[model samples]
Target chain A: MGKIKILNPGLLSTIQDGGRFGYQQYGMPVAGAMDLHSLQLANWCVRNPAHEACIEATILGPTIEFQSDTYIAISGATIQPFVNEQAINMNAGIKVRAGDVLSFGSIQTGCRIYIAIAGGFDIPELMESKSTYLRGNLGGFEGRALKAGDELEIADYERRLKGVVPEELIPNYSNFTEIRITSGAEIKRFTMDGVKTFLCSVYSISPQSDRMGYRLSGQKIEHANGADIISSGIVTGAIQVPGHGEPIIMMSDHQTVGGYTKIAQVISVDLPLLGQMKPGDQIKFKEVNLDQAQQLLLERNQWLKQHGIE
Target chain B: MIEYIPSGDSAFLVKFGNEISEEINRKVRAYFIALSNKKLEGIIECVPSYTDLMVLYDPLKIQYKSLLKELKILAENISEIEIPEAKTVEIPVCYGGNFGEDMDAVIAHTGLREQEIIEKHSQNSYLVYMLGFTPGFCYLGGMDKSIATPRKEVPSQKILAGSVGLAAEQTGIYPIESPGGWQIIGRTPYRLFDPNRKPEFLLQAGDYLKFYPISEEEYYKLNEND
Candidate 1:
């Protein structure tokens, strides 16, 4: 099988796909790529189906050597992906020769970068996905982040895949972002004044944040009754408030259930932005009705379909 | 009251009740099984907790109102839904000493002798409320309040998998190594979660779990096979 040999596994690089579902019933988390949109965008360049397994790297990235010729694409975060010190363009398919070394430079914009090959990663699928759940040591290239000396096989495919994301379709990864969220199921659990304060607050992403959830520190919102709730299902992007009154936004690797009261859920369209945010980035919440939030999701999907990349 | 609450754009939170009990959880499991049997279009996944069943769906395939309408119809006669009989699983736990670091703390907190604490913990059967918080981590209910203790002020940075612990009125097993505040009383030899194995999880919701005390030698002897 064709392979990519890892030379240096930068910060936190792992294989990920759409997500592992249907297993959440058994207490499993739906671990997937932090930025599904960017993963899909990179897959688009490689002519693979959307949601194919790809390498997800944090702000820093890995140095890898191609063991065979294939088309590769880089998307999200300007990591300055280079082949033998020669820079490659982002969002476009680039051809590589056997033994060519690909390394990354400092992150220029986004917090995460997705790297996709022509035929996707050839890791064994567990629970119908290649995404890694680090906590459980399940799935994805031996259930953990990539390391130096690990050889990852890629599916066999041949094509100088030609694709490029349109300017408007690219994500804007500014330090300060305004995210839109809909009221959570337990919205009334918090004081009306608390809800208003959340909308008006500008929170800085806490340093402790990771794939499981993003911790935000800002104004402490008041709970009408208390912060505790009967443990219930927690969806990705749900902003849960605990006794501390601080909000924790669930992310791709969020657990199946939580006991804290969730104040709101970030709209689906805006979720990808959370994946690209780094520690200390300022975020402010905006309110959108459920109808408007769903509309935004549909519009985003429509755009992807319109571009023949759905 | 059965209420349909808003979650996010792609899902709906259908709450059965506001509290955790066998009666309410049975309803959750019944609906989970019912929704599973429906093979409903656009429904991605259904996760049942103590009192809520969150149905995640694909907005591109079905709208919120349409899915809500379908869910209401299915829920109208939900209590009548037949659920599978509960399965009883017996777990052998070795309590106190190194296997249970917080055993002394628990004994002090409850003011009970070591043997009494062990007997009380193992004697009562706990209902598997839900399998969550971590993969294959069973949310057990019905721990004897005599041994009930509050969670530690500072959660351990890493609690090993298969550690049986107590928090408030609950006793749970850590299916995987994770940071937790539960007071550890014992450790189990059983691997509650093994991804490579068929079935993956040792316990599921709608099951009964009874713990039996085991000697340290027996714990290592049983664990050696795995």
Candidate 2:
């Protein structure tokens, strides 16, 4: 067993695993890490299962103190990380000696960062998940974001080994801003012009965005058919356009059901990219067919497996 | 009738016509029951709403195309499957006065006497169309059109659990304290949702609810035991 002490928890930090499943009927949102790709990569670096609990840091990163020797990895947003004033590379596992201080600077790109320690974070499971649902105040460190001075226990790992992730394996941040999406149920309701505008125009992430949803400020994509859609179940990455025509991308903490007309849905593979986007970040949507989207996901999964991440 | 289409990679939406009607609501409930019984693999959950059903699945185990194909087949076969009658539960409620702060507003909107409104509300049997918006919150159908009224102009910041409310042609019971826009006319003592319970939600989609008016004395009696 190991322990970590937070010296300065920046912005919002919480323990998250994959998500809470099999509870939609009970009206529980599937709360988890926003940037799942980075979370998995960090976990893989430490040889932990891809779904183990990790620290999801948003906007800012935390300063931590290690009470015992352990291996840790940082991924997602480009944060200049250091251990006792020595710079460390992101995405590769680093061995930290007892009493060493681990700190991170402001993010250079992206909004959220994921930190994975060997084994995983020690947190109680609620409804079979360690993910925190802030709305309901359930799971993960008393159902809230981690604050300064909070001590976190680390699960014991059977084996602790330093691992290196090649630079080629890391996602190219320059090409990471573009998001792929599949047209939604109400796609036909919009005119051809509306569709064209949605694909061509750039949208800025609104400051109102949070875990519940990301509201976008962009070109108005009107519904030509003037049909009032009935309420239906919504998932993460759903781009719902309300009466005002502004699109809102549902996030991990989005409501189980909504009545707005969804113009498109961000592909699952690119959802993590959307998760890392901060307020005022410009985003453009590229439409792709379902087959192509699945193919992309399959290729990504295979790449991870080939790199010993599975 | 309306068409069903893909909402996202993991879910499909079965949409009904523009207006909310009993026929469409019943079909949504029946289809939900049919899908629940089928127990398709990789399917995580299904949620029924006012006039639609959202089916969520796992993309890893099931591809979007294959799941869509299965859903098309399920949609065609839904009418053939027999739907079981919902379980009828009588919920005791305390009407008017401070218990229902918006009782006067409902009366003024409907132009009906307080007693008449209560009689009409309690006399009808409602079907639980869905559980959404909040935890254990039930969206009930079969409300009489005469008492139909729009939602409040400004929603209340806090509505106590077990508060009975009406919005437009729909009525529901709040399972937990939450912000709401519906006109509240009464309060029930029964606990609609309790996380500590095995099932968590007392009423599932497709259940039947009947309101039974109770005096203040009976309300306190039930509250005392709980």
Candidate 3:
């Protein structure tokens, strides 16, 4: 079996794929990579399936020692990925011999980086996924983040071929981003002033944000009624408003149900931008109709297919 | 009246009512069972909550408007949907000790004696509204308001699995160790969530859960037996 030995597990790294779906009814969250587009691109660089599990490294990355020759690609964050002490171009497949050391330097941009290896990470698949849900202690490597000296097994592949992800597809992880949103079920619950405040004001990402939610601190939007509502199913990117008037953007690891009133849902096409945002980043929401939001999603899928990445 | 709205690009929210009630819950379960039997193309899964159902689907295979139309038809005959009989599950709980770290806080807030609190808590059967917040965690309703308490000012960093807690007007069980703000009153020895098990979760939505008190020694005995 081919393997990679961890020498220095950077700030935080976990295994993720598409996500754990079809289990939200059982109180299970669909934990997966924050940025699905980047993960898919990384997998494409290795000629693997789109859902293959990869390593999601935070601002800092890990130092890994490969035990066998394989093809690998780095995407998302502009982490200066190096093999054997030399920098390598990201978004392009790179071949390495056994005993080669792979490491990363300072992050050039973005908060999370993805590394996809040939045949993907051969971790135990839970609920048909290898993504890690940290709170539940399920999936991924021992159901937790990677640590130094932990051995990870990669799927064994005989022939390693070079692949490329077009340069234009790479995203610029800007600190200030404009996120698009569609009105939510409870969109009418907010007063006109509240709606205006939400749309016009800039919100800074709170430090207490995580995979479960991104709490944004900005001008308090007054609601017509109280913020409490009947507990209902919450989708990813749902922007919930609690009684305190702060907005919380649900992410991939969001709970299956929540009682807070939701004002808007971030457009599916802009979720990758939200995923790459770090604490203290600024975000301004732009309102779009449901048709426009759905159209954007369709366009994204079509683009991915056109590039042969999905 | 039932209304289906787009939750996002890939899912739709099927809302049954504006408030939480057994009648609404039954409708959610009925429709969930009925929809699951449909095996609709592109329909991934349906999650039943207190007053709504989240129908996740693959937009590539089925359009949201088309799925909404199908759901509207299904909602028309929801009451006629045949749901399985609700199962009564008995859980043994050990009250007030190291296991229930926040037991004192609960007693202080309720002004009821420890035994009275336990009796009131264990008397009525709780309806499992849904399993959410964490794996195998059940959001139980029908707790007697006499002993109801608010969540802690600050959430604990870690609460043990199987710990039974009460917050606001609800009682719940933590399936895994995680951060929470509930006032714990007891612990059940039975495992609520086990990934190795066939169903993974011990209790599902629409199940009735009854609690019985046990001695601390008996709690350990049950754990040892498992």
Candidate 4:
């Protein structure tokens, strides 16, 4: 058992696992970590299950004090994390002795970060998940962002006495900024010119983006008809265009049902890439077939397993 | 009959039509029951919405093509299957005054007396078409056209739980406190959604609902009893 004390809860930080599934029938959103890839990588570094509960730090991160000796890993955005004012390396497992102070600087590229502990953060599960839903106040640390002075308990698991990390298991965060997308159900609703514009033009992430969805500011994609779609189940990476042609990519905390016409869907393999993007970052969408998307995901899974992450 | 389309990488949607109709609603409910009982492997959940049913599945376990093929078969088989009998529930509600603030607006829109509207609404048995918009919020069918009214232009910041309201052709009870635009006529004391409870939701889709008007004293007494 171990404890972590928060000294400076950053912009937004919350405990998250995989997600809440099988509850969308009751209008519950599948609230989970935005950047799942980073979460998995962080957990892998700590020798924990990839889906184990971890801290999802947004923009910046809180100053933390370790109450006991534990192994930890940091992934996602280059936040320039430090321990006792010394720069800590990103994407590598490190042992933290008791009373060590950890702090994070402003995001240099991405918007989010994941901090994983050896045994994972201990939080009550709701609907088979530890992810937080702020709107419903359902899971993870009272279903809200972590605050200063907050203490978190770490689950008990078999720990490795010797700190052993493979050299090649480290992830390259530089190439993940680009996002890939697939054609959505309402893709045909947009004009041929609109589709061309979507694929060709570059857009910037709007400041209004959050866990619910990322609102992008770019050239308005014109639709052929003024059709209002019925509210239906939406998934992460669904690029929904409301009355205004500006697209919003639905994320983890997005509503179970949405009425906007979805023009494109960010491919599952590239959703993590989008998750790392911060406001003002330039983004370009490249179209890919479903088969390619599936292949990419399979390749990613194989890569993880090959590196000792099951 | 409706067409099933791919929603995303992990789900498919069966859309009935653009307009709302009783026949289509019943078809959707029956199909939902059929699919639930079929129990396809890798299928995580099936959610019935206003005019569509969304099916979520584990992409790692089941390929998209095979799942779509199975759904197509299910859609073809839905017409021959019988829908299960729905449980009948009698819900007690307190009309107007404090609990329902939009009673006057509903009365004005319908151009009917408040008592007459209450009598009409309480007289008919409503069918739970779906549960959505919020946890335990039951989307009910069978509202008399005479009392049918449009939703508020500006939605209220907080509509109390169990507040029964009408929006266009549909009427529903708010299971949780949320921002809504429906014209509320009454509020129920029974908890619609309690996470501590075994089932969580008090009602499910396809359930039969009968609203019984109660006094303010009765509402408080029942609340205290629970």
Candidate 5:
């Protein structure tokens, strides 16, 4: 069995897969990799399945020591990775032997990084996913962030696939990001002026942002009526406007239901861009129709399929 | 008439009404049952809330327009949909002690005695509106507003699992230990969430919940069993 020992746990690191499905009705948040595009690309570098669990490090990354031979890939962010004191390339698979030290240097850009092993992490799956939901304390590495001295078991693979992802597929995670969105279910609750203000104004990510949701501060969005609404199911990327008028973008670990008005939903194609945003990052919303958003999703999926990354 | 709204690329909201009512909840449940029974291709799951149901689907397998057409037809005849009888769960609580640190505050808010509060709370059966906030946490309705109290000004740092709390027109049991602002008045020994259990959730959206007062001795007995 392949194994690795964590030395420095960094800021926030956890195991993640596609997400925990079939449990949202039970109030279980679908915790998954925030930057799914990077997760998929990392897995592809090692020739692992798209849904395989990977280590997601936010802002900072961990120092680890490999205990067995394995092929691994690091993607997302501009974190400098090293193997046994030798610098390695990002978005490329590398072979590590037993006792090799794996570490990361400074993060040059983006907020999160993904590391995928050839055969994935051998972790227990709750609700059919290894994704960790820390609040619920279910799934993945005992349902919490990795700490020093934690040992992770890796699955065995007969052969290793080593390659680098071409530059065309890699996303540029800029500090100032333009997140595209479609009008939400309660868009009508806002006045035309409110919608225009929302689409035009720039917002800064608040420090309180986490996997649950990103609290944004910007110009107040004036609603035609009070912001209260009957509680309804909420999905990831939903931009909920509370009585305070600030919009909060729900993320992978967001609550299943909310009572505030949702003015927009960041389109699927731009959710990855939102995921890479860190505190103090500036974002502006660009409106797109539902058809256009879906078409974008279709195009993204087609690209993933053609590139054999899905 | 049912209204369909786009939630995101992968899901859509089927709204039954703008108000929260048992009739509206029943409609939500009816449609959820119908769609669940049909096992429509590409539909992943349905989450039922107070007045709407969020249907999640695989975009690769189905389109929102086609799914909306199917939902429109299915929702039209919700009155005819048959679902399994909702289970009425009896949750035992020991009130007014260390278990309920905010019991005196609740009495002050409602101008009612401790016993009166307990009696009123246990006498009525509540409907499970939805499970959210935390795993297995139920949002229940049908509380006697006479004893209704607002949430604590400052929420507790940590509330143990199964703590029954009352907050502005609603009452619920915390299924897991979490930081909350609810005015806690009691605790139960029953486990609301067990990952090992087949149906991890003890209650569903349409289930009925009834709280009964239990003695401290009985509480210890049940706690030991868990």
Candidate 6:
């Protein structure tokens, strides 16, 4: 068995996979990689399965010492990665020998970083996922963020596959992002002016935001009626505006149901871009119909398939 | 008539009504079970709530139009689908002491004695309209308004698991420790969430919940048993 000792766990680092499915009905939040596309690409670089667990390093990244020769890959946020004092290329496989020190520099762009190993994390699945639900305290590295002195075992893999991801596939996370969205179920509950304000107004991410949801600080969305809805079913990406009117975009770990008026849902293709947004970052919503939303998703899937990244 | 609204690219809500009602919830529960049993391709899961059921699907496998058509046809036979009987789960609570942080506040608001408040809270059975907000946390219906207490002005940052409380006209249990505003009055030792158990949650939507008074000593015993 291979091991990696955490020298310094920066910001918030946790192990994640595709997420726990088939359990939302039990009020379980599906805790998964915030930027699923990045997670998949990182796994592809290391030749791991699409759903294999990876370390999700937020804004800041971790410093670690490798304990065995293993092939690894780094993707997502633009954090400079180094192996034994030498800088390494991201979205590509690099071989690390025992006692090699792997560390990362301050993030230049985006808000999260994903690191994947060839064989995957030797973490047991809880509720069929290695993803950590910190609030629920379930799964992944004791269901919490990694800290200094933590040692984790890695799975074994004999051969390292070619891990060059196409240049075009690498995402360039920008300062300000335009998130595409489809009108939500409670759109009718919002006035025309309210809807327009939501589409046109620029919002900044609140520092309070996390895996559960991104609370946006912007123009208060005027409810056609009162904002309260009978607590109903909700999904990730659904933008709910509470009585206070600040739109909160549900993220990867959103609860199954909620009571606020949901005005829009960020499209699947743009969710990755939303995931990369950090506190104080600016975002504007662009409305797209359901057809356009699904079309974008199809194109993304097709692109991933063509590049052998799926 | 059932209304279908798009939740996102991959999901939609099958809404039975705009308000909360047992009849509407029954329909939501029935359709939730029916759609799951149908096992339609591309459909991921169905989450039943107070008045609507959210159907999550794969956008790549099936488009919204085709899924809507399929859902419309399924609605025709929805009434025929029998919703399973709600299990009457008994939850024991140790009331009005150290276990309840906001017990005094609740007593003051209701103008009722501690024992009287517990008797009123436990004497009635409540309907589990849904399980949400957090895992195993249920939205229970039919709390007596006389004993209803407004939520705390400032919500607590940390509420222990199994804390039973009243908020507005609703009385429910906090399945897991979470930040909440409920006027807590009691605590239960029963584990509501055990991933290793056959059912991860203690209750589901459509389940009946009944609370009974227990001594603080009994709470310790039950807690140790779990």
lDDT of 4 by residue, B6-117 (tens): 7666677888766666667666778788888999998988887667788887677787888889888988877688877778899999999988888999888889998998
**Share of the reference A-B contacts seen in candidate 4:** 0.45
The digit string of per-residue lDDT tens for model 3 on B1-226 reads 7888787677888888888799889788888888999899999877889988889888778877788889998888766777788898999999988878888998899899999999999999999988887788888988999999999999999888888999998898888877899999899998988876777778988889999999999999897223
Tell me the tens digit of each residue's lDDT in model 2 across B71-146: 7798788768899877888899999887788889988999999999999999999887777777777778888888
The DockQ values of the predictions, listed in order, are: 0.74, 0.60, 0.67, 0.58, 0.76, 0.78
Cα error, residue A241 of model 1, in Å, equals 2.0
Answer with 5 or 6, whichever has the higher TM-score. 5
Q: What CAPRI grade goes to candidate 3?
A: medium
RMSD of each: 2.3, 2.8, 2.4, 2.6, 1.7, 1.9
Model 6, A1-310: lDDT tens digits are: 8999999999899999999988888899998999998899889988899878999999988998999989999989888899988999998989999999989888999999999988998988898899999888888999899999999999998798858889898888987899999898889999999999998999999999999999999999999999998888899999999999899999988998888999999999998888899999999889889899999889989999998877
* Model 6 lDDT per residue over B1-226, tens place: 8899999899989999978888888888878878888889999888889999899999889899999999998999776877677688999999988988888998899899998998999998888999888888889998888899999999999888888999999998887778999999999999888886777778888878899999988999889223
TM-score of chain B of each: 0.90, 0.85, 0.92, 0.85, 0.94, 0.92
Clashing pairs in 6: none
- Deviation in Å, model 5, residue B69 alpha carbon: 1.0
TM-score of each: 0.93, 0.91, 0.93, 0.92, 0.96, 0.95
Runs of candidate 4 with Cα error greater than 4 angstroms are A161-177, B16-18, B79-82, B150-155, B224-226
Clashing pairs in 5: none
Chain B alone, model 3: TM-score? 0.92
- Identify the candidate with maximal DockQ: 6
Better of 1 and 4 by DockQ: 1
**In model 3, which regions exceed 4 Å deviation?**
B96-118, B147-158, B179-183, B215-218, B224-226
Q: Which residue runs does candidate 1 get wrong by more than 4 Å?
A: B95-115, B149-159, B179-183, B214-226
Please give the range of 10 consecutive residues that has the lowest summed lDDT in model 2 chain B. Answer: B193-202
lDDT of 2 by residue, A1-310 (tens): 7899999888889888899876776577889989888888898889898978899998888899999988999999888999999999999999988899999877888888888999888877877789988887777888888988899999887667777776767665532378899998888888888889889999998899998899999898878866357667788899988878789999988888887878999988999888889888888999998888878888888887788776
Off by over 4 Å in 6: B97-107, B153-158, B224-226
- Per-residue accuracy of model 3 over A12-81 as CA lDDT, tens digit each: 8999898998888998899899999899888888888887899999889899999988999988988788
What does candidate 1's lDDT look like per residue over B18-77, in tens digits?
A: 888899998888888888888999999988889989999999899999999999999887
